[model samples]
Target: MPDQTTNAEKLDRDAVADRLTDLTEELRAGENVTVSVGNKDMVLTPPETVGYKIDVIKKQSRFRGNHETVRIEIDWKPR
Candidate 1:
């Protein structure tokens, strides 16, 4: 199957914290995770064992100063 992507973003500190907390709890509980962006929603159940990756990029610009973005991804397939 081809990969599909949906992007959701928030700059508010509280909003970002809430989203991160929700994701952490779902992963820790081993529950099916459901996420909604605008009118589209997706439910995913990761396998018992999965591969995880994290990437953080830092950038600097004369106009914008410095900033960084972190991306976390998980992958799994049932046997």
Candidate 2:
């Protein structure tokens, strides 16, 4: 099976933006991106090119209300 790590949490807009900014900085510097969730950390090095994908989903229901979700994925092979 493929190795997988997952972290899920609810944060304010600013917090979310901050996390993205940190990741962007690392990528821009061509350094390994350090992903930390609680106490676990995973280091990943992305090559010059990577696969990027984004998905946006919207759901509407009379009783449950409306909700929207955005998912972003970035992946690359190991050197």
- On lDDT, the leading prediction is 2
> Over all chains combined, what TM-score does candidate 1 have?
0.72
Q: Write the per-residue lDDT of candidate 1 for residues 1-79, one digit (tens) a residue.
A: 9646577665699988887788778778877877655477777788778898999999999999999988888777733
The per-model lDDT (C-alpha) reads 0.78, 0.88
Clashing pairs in 2: none
Which regions in candidate 1 have their CA more than 4 angstroms from the true location?
Answer: 1-5
List runs of model 2 lying over 4 Å from the truth: none
Error of 1 at 63 (Å): 4.4
In the order shown, what is each candidate's alpha-carbon RMSD? Answer: 2.4, 1.2
* Weakest 10 consecutive residues of candidate 2 by summed lDDT: 30-39
